[model samples]
Target: MPSHPSPPARSAVVVPYAPDAPPPQLAPLAGPDRPGGPAVPERWNAVDRSAHAPHLVAVPGADATEWIAAALVTARPGTSYLKIVDALGDVPAAVGAVLETARRRGLAQVKWEGWTTTAEEATALGFTPLRTPPGAEGPDSGYIRRLYGAEPAAPPYYAQTTHFTCGAVTALVARAHAGALPGEALDRDAELTLWRAATNFPACEPVGLGVAVHRAWPSAPVTVFLDTEDPVLLDHLPEAEQEWRAALQRLSRADAERSGTPVDPRRLSLPEIRAALDRGGHVLLLVSLATLQGFDVPHWILCHGTVPGAVVVDDPWAHAPAGDTWVDAHLLPVPDASLDAMSVLSPARFRGAVHIAPASTGP
Candidate 1:
């Protein structure tokens, strides 16, 4: 799937308003009186109407300004520094720490306040040190003044609209192809989709519970088979279909014993099994078929219609024994004698034949 557009830079602008400035209109999502009901509207709207609205607030803390600025220049202005500050309770100490860290990392610098740094100071600290033209003025210009100085309007918002930085995109896509995700969904889009699908609410709206998934495999490279009349993007799933079956059988048998209900392992589909593994709170079971051959569960495969390389992981299980009868063909039952020599594989590498290490066992 195509990646989501990078959030624009300049997430929030510091528009100067008098202390008595009228409440900026809330984003329709935020207004209690609005049709959306009590839900807080889009953050930008909230920023306009917030009690600290007119003040030049960085996302709540001092730390926000630097990261926020960095994000702005990089084209992710969706959530500005001050907006984050409000959400995080505007803690000065925490925010200040973020700023200090940014400076040390040469990511950003402060201007205007006593805490501000000069170009030379910024360069020494490893920053490129951007500044605005002298004497620039406007509602938006106020934001620039507070950062670099009274000068040219900060770079136009669109200037930041380049493709997601290489690091960000690579990481996001890698996660997506790895069966950890239904498919590789960009963070912003995936979260929004989950919020909407799970609650029938908009992405910006709040949900009581947060759910996440991590496919334990690498995204397989997608291959198109022109040999057939139809070009199917054949992507490999990490675990063989049989391994998935084994996992499900193991899980179903355990669940049956625990709930005193019979659940046929054969009936569970791939998606259902994946959903179960993705649930929060459970001690996840992972089996790593790392060196497994192609027919058994190739290490790579095509993903849901897109992405040349997508990793795939299927249902996971817990290592805890349900009962003697719960043993199923899906897993290699641990030998009682070797139980003391076992170690649970990392969740990301759950495809191997391994056993949980008993705490009583010594090296």
Candidate 2:
């Protein structure tokens, strides 16, 4: 993976809690600095009056472990809690507590560390140690690269194929927005293969989503128009595919001529895009990966005064609803569901293509 800047330091402290552990009867730490001033003694329980009372009741420092732990519990599982504490402080326990409270309150996906007394432990704690592939060590960083030839890129650790899946789709979507033509369909088959090979590796969902979005219009009824006035943005596109590049340039020139004006390479208005699609033209979603994180029709509604304009359907892809399902794309099938529902682009890697169907063509 590409090296990121050195992470901040972490404080040495352990918050006590177990996975599925019952909620602790919490007493608010006394703090005159708090919004309403320090908590009163009447609120303290018998445990609050003990030897740990003075320390527990004291106002937390900026690096307080309790504060750190509370924040982590809301995060996705497998997130680095040490990094949170390093940036904040010794509070894994406190974060776990907050997360536990949220879970009890009905948060289904509360984030917490998967701890185990035996390396083989699984069912009880809800964590199963993945077996090491031939010539590899533990679960965290092996398997994929060892079994397959793909290597992970910079921070967030995505493999080469994974990056290409997103990067290629992003470039294609940009071209389409600039008015590119329909070209050789993206390789969704290869993308799924790479994803399955890298199961348990982070950002797998983003990679898969990118491929699904890019390949959304294979022989589908969609037309893309591009602006010819602006220079092509194909410099960063993948080199393995030359046919795709030529098609984009053609579309851009055609779009520019049709509009009788220059297309803004930096931005495309929603009305203009929708009008083209309304007329049976296919729309290509061209947005950066950074902008894609947590993106949806709702976000576009806030920014563009329209639904995302593109609606991707869930096609063949892997999903593990139960622990019994093995991680393999071969077992998965293209879903008959809406693309948006199945191809969930994670906020972590926010960029890819989304095909807009015709006005008379969707739900």
- The prediction achieving the highest TM-score against the true structure is 2
Query: What are the per-model numbers of colliding residue pairs?
Result: 50, 28
Cα RMSDs, all models: 22.2, 18.3
Compose the digit string of candidate 1's lDDT tens values, residues 37-153.
Answer: 342223223333222222332232244433222110110111111211121122232234334433343331222111123444333322233323122121111110111112211
lDDT against the true structure, each candidate: 0.22, 0.26
Over 129-217, each residue of candidate 2 has an lDDT whose tens digit, in order, gives 33321221112211110111112120111112333343333333333332333333224454454334322122222222223333433
Model 2, runs deviating above 4 Å: 1-162, 167-189, 192-219, 223-229, 234-248, 251-285, 289-354, 358-363
Clashes of 1: 50
Q: Which candidate should be chosen as best, given lDDT against the real structure?
A: 2
TM-score of each: 0.18, 0.28
Q: Indicate the residue-level lDDT of 298 in model 2.
A: 13
